[model samples]
Target: MKTNPGQLSQLLKKSLAPVYLISGDEPLLVQECCDQVRKAAKEAGFHDRLTFHADHQLDWNAVADEFSAMSLFAEKRRIEIHLPTGKLGDGRAVLERVLQEPPEDIILLLISTRLDAAETRRKWYKELQGKGVHVPVWPVDADKFQGWLQQRASSRGLSLTRGALAIMSERLEGNLLAASQELDRLALLANGNTIDEETVEQAVQDSSRFSGFELVTELISGRAPHACKMISVLQQEGENPLGLLAVLSRDLNLLLELKSAGGQAENPASFLKKRGVFQPQRARAMEQAARRLNRAQLHEAVALCSQIDRATKGFDPLSPWHYLRDMSALLATRA
Candidate 1:
């Protein structure tokens, strides 16, 4: 059945499903759910758990043979199939047949980076849901991030100050892996004491080169030299061009929203606060960009960003870094 994330623990307590289809873009949540399932299976005496990485070349017959094999001890068996790309390939036929008549005494877990497509969902996914459990672990948004942080801190016997939590949340940008790593680091440094904002600020450097607010500060303040330098540094640091494009797109889209709102507030933070831009740094950046750039210029910058993104995906001749540099120069120019 389709299960919500909140209900997963309760579901796990009652009975383990014959098959679990856990799919989402959130790496931490997905892994956590899988870990939970594995732990529960282990507790139920499922010691012979096997793992398979599904790929385009996966052998369906071999997989079937393994699943259908009788356990030496006749105990419960667990099988985890991790499909990172979520493409089942030619194995769909075998999988469908198995799903029609699932093997007894074996718990099958299917993990994917994201949910199957609508068609796949209707076919294999629907069948699994009817016979077993389908859980979708979505990414944690900003509102839910605080609870996650607090729980993480509490688990480590570390108390995090409100200010520190806010800063940590901002720095991690809702990425649980980064947030978890930072929490671990903070726990180590604090030695079970309370972590304050100053500690976080001192420990964490602003490593994000493609941060929209930072880029806006560079462009609006007429720091073309700095903007160019930052772009080069980011590329050298192996930052993904597509990721940078996403940041730019998000910022430009917010700017467009603010422009449409038709406000000339002296403190743009208040205006942005009303518009759901809660991060203080992001609000400040938006304010700066709003003051310096006109609507037309913002639209042009967004278009250029989209073009660079498309070109990076092999639609043009220029390399992603070169395209980014050119776009940065164009953005630096006053329209």
Candidate 2:
């Protein structure tokens, strides 16, 4: 059956599946799930483990051979297969065939960043649900994220105020990897005391100011100068251009969603919290932006962002700063 990231530990404690198919777009949750599986396997005395990458072309026979061969060193073995790009073809056939006459002392863990579609899930995923575990790692919402942050702080024997949590959540923007890193930094910086809002603000700087939520806010507010300055700062700090484009694309999509939802205010924070927008500042910024930027302008901004994204990813060696400057100028213009 489909399981969430939070319930993974309890599941592992109760049952050990012969095969685990872990899939999701959220890298942090996906990785955490994989870690849990590995840790559980190790604890259960499956010390000998093998890892394979799906992206690297290998003979299917080799994988079959590896599964067939018994480990000389350990009584049980765990094999981890990472499909980073999710190019694993008709794994159902191989898996079904193997599962029919399963190996006695081997467990297989298939980790992927992309989940099968609903149809695929109905077909292969459903079959595996009963026999093996199918864990879907979804992005944590903002409200849940606050609890996670508090738990993380408390685990380190530290405390955080509500305002500090809000600021940290805002700075991290529901990116759990970034949030976790920032929290770790804060834990170290605080050194066994409650972390205050000022300390959190001082700890985490807006690294990519002209991207993601910040970019959306600046463009919406008609603050071209601030956007330009942010772009320069990001460039000087060696931020990747294509990376910036991806962030812009995501932000534009969110703006479109807000625009489509209309002036009802519908709690963008709550909506985005489910999609992993944990920070209060970001939620407020988007709320303000929704009021200011019209649908047409938002659409145009999205188009510009997509074009810039493609250009940056292409072989054209032009300066990314120039493209960013031009985009800023275009965004500055009144609709």
Candidate 3:
């Protein structure tokens, strides 16, 4: 009745459940599970898909009416209810009524944001889980991310070295979408199916005039002019803003961590060594960035990165490049 993202594919192979309740905050993982269910449903001859957004403005009466009605397009239907806020609200009673005796002709797919423990205890969720399958997707955390990456790479028929994994885990951690994209790119460009650190670096370097790491270096080194130029170049080159943000986010987070760890008190090299920043040049650059920027500034820059992310995704009005330039100026500012 209950499963995880990894097991969903196997479960789908067994048989398609009448109901699939997928809840998660991680977009990629959640989408992957949803895709599996849709594919399986289609294969099982459930072709006509109807989607309803369970927002406050939604007419629950219409949703309920649609459930009871026969599909004019196809005999079997796949009904998807998307609950962005993870709350059914008025739809709670409607869902309960619909599921009381779900039509054999329809497959119900309920997708939502991460459901809190309280939400999990709700009658609708309990009923969905009991009746069919509930796949709760969780974010791949720092400790487990590398393992996830290795498995993903293997699935794509790519071999990754330890160093390659480390660099990837450093740059792509906490962002599965970017990680997946990078791996997909590697699958095409990789030579002889083997991906080492150099391969990864080359991939990043080839993307633009300045790679994400180089942009970070410019920002942290307080080279406002060069950093701004790099951002401009990256924008002109049509680089995905998300990729640039990924690298910036990682470095800003590390600087914040070092600041929190009392990194300023110890020798820069020693502190960096303890933190696994072995490269002398990178160590020196991070050390200087840490000293020049305060915790408050780093926090501001981090927040700005979030804004850039939203803008890039069309959630915000301004262009992502605007936020990118602003973030560069903020980080390039001396404490």
Candidate 4:
């Protein structure tokens, strides 16, 4: 059955499903679903567990092989597969055969990126949903993020002032894992679950220093020097290179999108609406980024970001910070 993340706990409480396809990009939500499944499986006497990560050139036959092997050892076994690439390919046929009559002692848990509508509508997928649970999670967007953070904080015994919560929300920027970790940190420091703006500022250094959004704005508005300076300042202030790079990549993606949408650049509001970007501030930033940079320059920015990505992964010889600083300058001035 198709289920939302909120319904997962209750669903698991009643009975464990034979097969589950939990898909989403949000790490916390996906992890939560998997945790619920794991807990339920363990409680239900499903001891033996096997895990697989699907990559290019993976032997699709391994699915059947592992399931069978796990079942041989344990009466109740679970097989978990991670397909971040979303390339089901020939594996779908294998999965279909495996799940044709969902095994009584085996539970198949498939984790993957968000499946598009077309993929979910496939015969094998529909049958899988029929036999088990299909849980999907969406990110806590900007509009609902603050409230979610507040609730999360409250659960952790941290009572943050509205101003403090706002600062935390912006600093973490909808990252649930980071938000959860920061809440733990705040709770440890909390005298009586109460936190003030200053305490928050101290907890997350540079909460007020330089924002990711401000960096985007400076770059998109063609303030090369300011963008470069902000990059340096933010870097020194302990901003995450990956997070900053993510924001910059988003900016380039938006610009590339606008460039592809011919004649839409003149009407920013309409374009933003068409693109489903609701946040007015972000919409404005994207529109401005699209307007300021041309197609070629935006592509160059994307290439620069790719280099930074490689550096972040230790694939490049240069420091990611160095690549980021160069990217900031390029976006601000040229690309």
What does candidate 1 score on TM? 0.61
lDDT value, residue 167 of candidate 3: 84
lDDT tens string, model 2, 92-184? 556656666567688889886555354244444555676688787665655687888778778777799999988876666546666666777
How many clashes (backbone N, Cα, C below 3 Å) per candidate?
0, 3, 0, 0
10 residues in a row with least lDDT, candidate 4: 205-214
lDDT of each: 0.70, 0.68, 0.78, 0.72
Using TM-score, rank the candidates from best to worst: 4, 3, 2, 1
Candidate 3 or 4, higher TM-score?
A: 4
What lDDT score goes with residue 123 in model 4?
72
TM-score of 3: 0.66
RMSD of each: 9.5, 8.1, 7.9, 5.7
For residues 237-318, write the lDDT of model 3, one tens digit per residue.
Answer: 7777765565566567678778877735676577667655666777788988988999899868866765675587686689
lDDT of 4 by residue, 1-335 (tens): 99898889898988888998888656567777898899899889888888766655568787777755635554788888876534476688878777778778888899875664567767779788778898987767677889998888877777889899888877886456567767888888997957989999888754431476577667666777777787787778666665555555555665676777756445767766655566687677777666666788776776666566557657669977787667666666533
Q: Which candidate ranks first by TM-score, i.e. highest?
A: 4
Runs in model 1 deviating more than 4 A are 119-121, 208-335
Candidate 1 pairs with clashing backbones = none
The residue pairs found clashing in candidate 3 are none
